[model samples]
Structures are given as C-alpha cells and as structure tokens.
Target: MMTRLKIGACLTLDTLPDHRDWIFEADRDLELQDFLSHAALTTDRDVLIERARQALDGFRGKLSIHGPFEGLDIDNKDPELRPVITARFLSALEVADRIGARKMVVHSPYTLWYQNNLHSYPGYAETKLARIHDVLGPVLRRAEELGITLVIENIQDVRPETRRAMVDSFGSDAMALSIDTGHAQLARRMSGAPPVEDFVRDAGAQLAHVHLQDVDGHADRHWAPGEGEIEWSAVFRAIAECEAPPHLVLELRDATHIPAGFAYLRDRGLAV
Candidate 1:
C-alpha cells in the first residue's frame, strides 16, 4: 500500500489563493492574536472572526491552530509570570475552540542552553518537567473538555527523551506530539542535537502534527522540501511506519514555495 496521510498547508493570508481542498494549520499573525487575547476579544476580534468565517466559508478540510509561545514558557518557575503565561494559554485554548481547531501546536520549553548544562545540575530536568505539568495541567484538562488535542512541538530540544517524558506525564488523551523538520534539522547541525529522524522515531504513535519544511542544515531556511539538503527518503520512511499517520503541514516561508513542496512529495510517490 502507498503511504497515505492527511497533507495540509499552513494558512497565511498570502497563501489563501492556493488553499483549495488542503487541510490547514492557521498561521499566527495580528488577526489570530486579536482573537486569542482576552483584551482584544470585543472590538478587534469581532471583525476578524467575521472575515475569517467568510474566508473559510467554502473550505472543506480539517483545521489546527499554532498556539502562542513567543515569550511564554510553561516551565517558568517565576511565581508572578507563571500565572500570566497560564492565562495566555487559556486564552489561546478558548480561541482554538471558537475557530473549530481540533488541534493546537505548542512549543516545547526545552532549550539548548539548559541541555548544555543539564549534567552539572542533577535532577534539574525533572524539576522543570514538574513545573511544566503544574502550569499546563489545567490547560490540558480544558483542551480535553473542548475535544482538542494539545500537540507539543520541538523547538530547541536537543534530545527527545525530555519532551517524551513530559508528554507521557500528562496521561491525557488530548496531549500529543508534533515534529518540526526544519527546527529539528537546525538543532542538530547548529547545536549537535540528535538527528531529525530521532524525533519521529521517538514520537511514534503519539505524533499528531508536523511542520514539514526544508532546511540547509544550519538555519531555519523553510524552503521547499526538495530545495534543501535534508534526507527525504529516510524522513518519509519513518513517517510511513507510524502506527497512525500525523497531519503533514507544509509550513514554507514563502507562499510561492508551497507548490514546489507538494511537487517534491509527489515526485517521491509520497503524496496523499
């Protein structure tokens, strides 16, 4: 049997012209923020919601949202900032429910700096993991209440074990994993992190979403899949073997590169 999966594109205003029949992960921008922030809910969000409804009126496919994580850390130990971060995540979750997003992609808090000095401080990882649970426990419960899957995406995670541990700790059906190929590649080349395949291999059945992009082995190039030096065959092979295929999202930097990305997958006989 051929490798079959629900392939999707990241939805940006510039790329909406090419968004026929493809599943989509809503892009983060001013519009999304307006809907996600409690402060902007009344005036700014009302207009954006109407516009979004009109724009997506004819679209027929599954939807996901990328939750806010720019400066928010679920593992933050600060007493004052912890509540603030929790509120932001709660807001994001509410927005996800309103938009009919079945899944929300959140960034992992594991960082390169922390990993580099992890050995010096014994049990630090465990403590941080506990903090993460404490902060996100309610959010995860709320997501479960809303029938949404909370997918944790690897950002600067040098190794998969820490993140895998955190996800396992949740023990909620609503909690899952996401793999960003470009971010994983950049972590490996720039920080001597594990190979990109390691993430898919470890995530296994827990994988629920993906950010499929090409990288030049150093920076987050986000080029078309075939335009960079990533080993595509191994990546696809790993994905094909998953117990349940994840949502493959073409999250390219430019809208113009999306067709080329789809073409690359087609040429490889991996298109769904």
Candidate 2:
C-alpha cells in the first residue's frame, strides 16, 4: 500500500536494528535521531555512524539526521561563544554527511523571551540574524559542500517570520525550514505562538523536513499521532500544498508506537 505522501520514522541505533526491515518494506524515509546527542557525536561517534551507515546499506528512501541542540545557541551574542557553537554544529554535520543524509535538522535560535522583549533593545531582530550568521555561516558552507541541506526546526519560536528571515539571510540552497508539530503546539498553548498549521503554511516550499510527533498542546508529548489534540487534517492539508515536498518523520519517543502513529495517519488517508 503506497502512502498518499511518503512518510518516515525517526530511529535510534537501538531501534534501527529491529526496524530496518520495516524501514525498507515500503521505502520509508529515515531520520537518524540518536546522533543529536553528545555521546553519539563525541568519543563514540565513529563507532556510532559506522554502525548506522552499515545497517542502512540497502535503504531506498531519503535520509536525514537530527543535529545536536541542547544548551547551544546558533545566535549566541558573544563573538567568542559563536565559534564553539559553530564547532558543535559542524561536528553534527560531519555525522550527517558521513551517513549520506540529505538534510540535517538544527534547532531554531528564536525564543519566546526574545520575541516578547523585542523592544528592549534597538535592532534586536537584525542583531539576532547577524549573530546567527556569525555562527552558522561556516557550517552552512560546509553543509552545502557536502550536498546536505540544513533545516531549522522551531523550538520556542512564536514568531515564524523571524525564522523565515534567518533562513532567508543565508540565501543558500542548503538552508531551509523544518517544523516540529509538538513544539509549535506547545508554544501556542504556553505562550500564544501561532498554531502548528500556520508553521506548515508559512514554510511552504522551503519546508524541507518535519518531525511528526503528536503533542497535547501543553508539552512535548511526542505521542502517537491520534492521541494528541493537533488538527491532523489541517496539518496534512498544508503539508500537501508544499511545493518542494518534505520528509515527514514520525518522531515519537517510544519507537514501539511509531507503527501506531503511521497507522493513525494512514487510516485518515494522510500517509501510507
């Protein structure tokens, strides 16, 4: 049974071995989520990427990787701090490149705090973009060189246009947008951010990747799709309208529930 739109799952090495057959059964796309951690990126990175690359030898679908984001900011104000951030992202991109990933998902730098206090300083938005470029500039070049696109996933971004500008500032084909439905919904629920649907609509063709987890609109639930409050129909409708299309990944916390999530969307004719 072919999916209405191609969909995939975010998998860790632990789950990868068990699900490799399922992953190939229908040629589903894959997002390597484990490399987004410190343990997988440092000290043990070679062993990790080698194992994942070996296991995915026959995968026919597109590939992506989830880059590290914890405690790192792409737009760090300190010029001294920007290099460290850049190093971290470049390391993650190395993993993505080695694994032959088409895209790498990086966390957006925008925050609810930054958006709320836009008036606190002059040229806040412009400075933010400049800082981001200072850090991500080299990483972007490296990504383009490796034939990999960098997709910025929304975290505390209440203002989607700001994310748009950050992506636009690079003006490189390697830069694009990603939406984590759960995070967008949590921002809307907690701080009046735009709904998840709006994020999808705004990204339009430039939307290259998506983390398709369902949330309660209260927190980062990462639940199976049908269990959450998000309007799946509207979300998929907007996704269907995308001009560039995207890799839809079921990013559930429990890999066991991924089949359930895929079924939920498939039953509704949203995916396979």
Candidate 3:
C-alpha cells in the first residue's frame, strides 16, 4: 500500500550513502552570511551547486532542501541587516531551484528570549512578527513561483500557538509548519510548554513537514524515534489524525540510526 505521507532521512555531506529508495532532506552548507559579507558569489555558488548534484546523484526519490539558517535572522531588529538576510534567503531559494527540490525548511524567527522578555515590551511580539512577515514575503513569493512549499520549523518556539498565529497571518499556501519533535520535547521540559503530541495536534492542518527525532525531554538529543523517552505511538497517532499528513524526515544525530528509525516506524505501521 502506498502511504499518504513520504518518509526520508536528513542527508548531510557525510551521510549521502545508499539511500536510493528513500526521499531526502538536503542541508545547504554554504554559510550565506559569510558569502554576503565577502560579496563573493561566483566560486562559492559553483562549488555549492556541483557538490549538491554529486551528493544527490543516483537518488530516485523526492527532494527537499533545508534552507540556510545558521546566522541569518528574518526578524532581526536592525534595519540595515534585514536586506542582507533577505538576499541570503533568496540565494537559498536559488539553490532549491537548481536541485529541483519540492519544499524547503526554514527555522522560525521567534525565540525563547522573546518569550522571556514578553512583558518588557508590550507589543514586541507584534513588532517582531511584522518584521518577519515583511522579510519573508519576498522569499515566500519566490518559493511559490518555483512551486516550492516553505516549511517553517520551530526552534526556540515555546508555544506552538505563537508560531501558528504567525503562519496563519500570512494566509499563503506556500508557507506551512515543520514540527521538530525533539525541539518540542525540550521546550516542554525547559519552558513548561505542551508536549510533542500536543504540538502535532495543535499544528494539525498547518503541519506540512516534520523532523521525527526523539529527545529525553531535557535536551535536544536528536536520537532515533524509539531510543528516547518520547511516546512514539502517541506522536504517530496524532500525525495520522491530521487533515493533511506531513513529510516525515528521520533527522537523527548519527547516520547509523537511520535504518533502526525506519524499522521502528515500520514495526508500528507508521513507515511514512
């Protein structure tokens, strides 16, 4: 039977092994902030594209690109820095296009620092959200034009509602949620937020992508699904109940865990 969801593993330079049958989530390695700082595009761009093609060769499966998210911030308060950020994002979208990627994963602009200082500035959240919308608008339009779905993953988002509200405000079909199970578990332990299953349920229809890793509830361990204390059964069930199923990627810390993670999901009848 063909599952409604697609399953894959996160492929870095080191893990581009014999994954010919599974889908892939390719990570962009070029640090765009550095490129933007140096104003050098030709050599680096050529190398990035060549390496991406080599890494993706012989893979007959769907592809998604993990957009550059190291030092770039879409919600940066600095006016001058916003353009640089947007330009770097545009570069990432270009890479996605070259690779024929169907979707891209971007980290949410919200952070735990904002939540901690929520009371300091009464309208800070609104201001940050507005800036994020403005910064991401062009990138989202480009993704839509390229037939790509830009999935926003939660990093420091303690409350899924805040992220959901931000995504809903755009009202664009090109943008959607990419839930990271390990991050959610860590947030629940560190900030008293909801658990992993609750996040999946809350995301519901908005969920379009997922990092199906597990954690010990204290830190982002990024272990295989069944190796940690997370309730895999409950999480998968919540996902199954969603109106739109999401692409499930085994974002394990170690590549060796990939086979075990797939087996664990298969045993539970949640291969996708």
- Computed on alpha carbons, the lDDT of every model, listed in order, comes to 0.76, 0.88, 0.76
| Model 2 TM-score on a 0 to 1 scale | 0.96
User: What digit string (tens of lDDT, one per residue) describes model 2 on residues 1-272?
Assistant: 22378788999878987677778888888998888767778888999988988888888889999888887888888888889889988999998888888899999988889888899999988888888889899999999899999999998899788798789889999999999999988988988988888999988878999999988887798999999999888888888888867988999999999889989998899987
Model 3, 1-272: lDDT tens digits are 32434467776644565553444333321111122322323347667667677867655555677777767787988888888778777887787778667778888977788778988998997899888977898999888898888889999889898899888988899999999999988888888879899999999899988888888887889899888888877788888888976777788778788779888878777764
Best by TM-score: 2
Cα lDDT tens digits, model 1, 34-77, are 34344444346556556666666655466677777766888988
Lowest summed lDDT window (length 10), candidate 3: 28-37
Models 1 onward score TM values of: 0.89, 0.96, 0.86
Order by TM-score, highest first: 2, 1, 3
- Score residue 180 of candidate 3 by CA lDDT: 92
lDDT of 1 at 242: 89
- Residue 128 of model 1 has an lDDT of 89
User: What's the lDDT of the predicted structure labeled candidate 3?
Assistant: 0.76
